[model samples]
Target: MTLAAALAAGAAQTQTQAQAQALAKLNVVAFAGASNLAIWAGQQQGIFARHGLEVALELTPNSRAMASDLYSGKYDLALTSVDNIVAYNEGQGEARLPGPSDFTAFFGVDDGMLSVMAAADVPDLAALRGKVVSVDAMTTGFAFVLREVLGQAGIADQVEWVAVGGGAQRLAALLEGKQAATLLNTPLDLAAEARGFRRLARGRDAVGAYQGIVAAARRGTLAAKRDQLIGFTRGFRESLVWLDANRAEAAGILTARANMPPPVAARAATALLDPERGIFRDLRIDEAGLRTVLRLRSKYAQPQKELTDIARYIDPSIRAATFG
Candidate 1:
């Protein structure tokens, strides 16, 4: 190569390295589901990179691990149920943390399209009576939602409740006939139904407006990595908007990243982008939905006092700064 040409190439490489180094990195963990389409799309389309952020996404086995990892600083942020943030913050979580839990949700994702998927032979809720049911934890995630469904079915006292970990694990047990049913979200629920499991009820239908997953981090992390958090939150919001506008691209993403069949992936993408029941377009926490979460926790949580304070689990300043 010529001397001037080689020098120009070297300078360009140095500039690229500098730009990459300037971008903040965030380690994020979330439950495995199609709800993570935004994250996957963001990474694929370079939305986060364009926002001066580098993201590493990992799928957690269960909420307990997500909680413990966050507490120990293994991850910078989490996409989890707002219920989990409330549970850990209120000392009602399944896994006890090392110190006082200050987990907080900073952004809303979706109303957890939680559905109770029962065995094929189990025709209805009545068939679930005297049968085994699974949950991520007895105290976190959507356990209370499942409880409410059974109670409404008049079989709350009859079914055996088991802590079976995350959606993937719970789905496994259900498929193997080890558990009769469990609350599943997104493509997992869709996959279950496709496999002959019956979706007995949806959480929203059983209760009312419900808050599902939210972007969260510990208070210390929030304060420490404020810039990265803002970038991530902004990137996620942009990703959602992009996915809504680009259906074909989103279907491809779901099929490839989520390991879904083409048709199921397309359907999952449609479900996530639905105007009413899909992801929250504005990415703002729904007050009524949060109230539903609080109400359910208030009724089912152990040693529970009435929990009505929505602000206790959310940090809104970041969203304000990012969007404003």
Candidate 2:
């Protein structure tokens, strides 16, 4: 081979390696379901790659563990309930960490399409009386939302509560009859309905306006990785847009990631695409929703305190910059 040819080939190889190395690496912990379809769609569509980010997504088994891991720098970011952020920031978290948390929600994900599901035999909230209901924790996460829901139904004092880990575990417990009822999100709710479970109430219908999930990270990480975080925000936004436009492909991705059948996956996709209450059309934090979160938390959170300022736990600059 000619020397010129060899030099050209080497140069091309070097350029390719440089481009690959330039992609920013980010570790994210999130719940597993159709609500997180944007993450899966981002990966499947190479949106993250296009924006120069290499994201590693892990499904959280428990909110407390995820919070601890996030605080310890085990993961760079977490896609979890805004309530989790509020709980930890206020020192009311179920799992205590050594130091004060520096976490802040910089992006809005969804309204936590949560549903109250019961065994086939249990027809409604009234029937759940005297039976055990599972939750991630008795004090934090969606447990409070469930409480408010029950209170609205006037059955709050009727049922027993148990901590059964995350959504997947709760679903399994409910299916096996270990628990008479539990809260489920996304495709799981659809799946539960398919398996003969009855949907007693929907979160939005029961609890009213609520902030579901957000992308949170240490304030220090946000400052240090501003460029990469922006890239992620952009990529995530693009993924949501893609999912809106490409339902079939998004459903296929959901089916593969969540291990759901094609029909169930399609229904999940439709639920997520709901313009009114599924994924946020624009990733802007809802003030009313955050207030609703605080109201619910104050009623149930340990060491409960009045939490009116939503800005205390949210940093909207990143989202504003990315979306604006």
Candidate 3:
């Protein structure tokens, strides 16, 4: 072949290959817990592959820490509390990231609620006043949650928030009354109730609707790989919809992947579809929700330029994309 002709052919091939690479693989990580199994469903069901992409699922210890690692390039996307992303971006709450937070959520996963599960006969939220309560992760996790919970119970200033690691330890504290009331989630919340822990409502009872875990890419990663981010969100959104529509089957997948006991996983699955606590509603980023998050995060952050400054951290384009 002529040199010019050969060069043109090589260029054409390179262009095609680059296009394929642009539409390549995607990787995401989830917060460590049983309820986060929706991400597992996406992987197990080949939703990512069906969308012409590859996905990797990693499990991080908690939302805040997972979000911080997301910024450091540890994961392309994080399945964590939507509030953590908002709080980190607002430079408030338990966010360890310095500078203004710049993370944005792509799609919703689950809606998790916090419950004040205390020993039976301990009475109501007001009853815990003047006593110490246990939180999951000190600054970021249930501490921020209880501040709102306590305030709603009309006794925020009266109670002290203490750390008790994850749910198991927190349950231990609540059982022994070492801590007045500790945050508990479903399955555990139901289990706590069964174990004589008085159920005193949940975050949904007090705080209306909030997205639990969301698929988010760090600002830099999203900027560099917008295509991949879009593809990943598409797969995850489909997975969420599929899980909702096929609850019984989805639960079985979660049961196998997460290794949670069948009955416990079943309860968690049912909660995932409940209109009150489910996170699968349209997956759009609620401006009002973000504003509410800003107000809440502001309560945790250093006083600066008020809640308006909090708006700077969230970029909603990817979230907007998932709607279509």
Worst 10 residues of 3 by lDDT: 302-311
TM-score of each prediction: 0.94, 0.94, 0.77
* Cα-based lDDT at residue 118, candidate 3: 79
Instruction: List, residue by residue over 1-324, the lDDT tens digit for candidate 2.
Output: 599999999999999889879988999998765547898889878899998988889998999889999999889999989999999999999887999988999988787889999999998898888999889998775898898888887878888989989899999888898999999988789989989999999998877778888999999999988888999999998998999899999889877888888998899899988887678868877788899999988888879798899989999888888977
> lDDT tens digits, residues 1-324, model 1?
599999999999999999889888899999977558999999999999999998999999999999999899999999899999999888888787888899999989889988999999889899998899999988875999999989998999999989889998998889899999999998789878878899988988999899999999999999999988988988988998899899999999988987778888888888889988888877888889999999999999987779999989899988998899
**Each model's lDDT:** 0.89, 0.87, 0.67
lDDT of 3 by residue, 1-324 (tens): 599999999999998777557556655666444345556777778787667676777666455567667777777777666677766765554546656566777665555556778778778887987888777565553465667888888888898877666565576567777876877765467656756778776875666654455667777888998877777777767777788788888668757865556776687678766665665556655555555555565575454425654345455687676565
Candidate 1 residue runs with Cα over 4 Å from true position:
1-16
**How many Å off is the CA of 55 in candidate 2?**
0.7
What residue pairs clash in candidate 1, if any at all?
Answer: none
- CA lDDT, candidate 1, residue 121: 89
Number of clashing residue pairs, candidate 3? 1
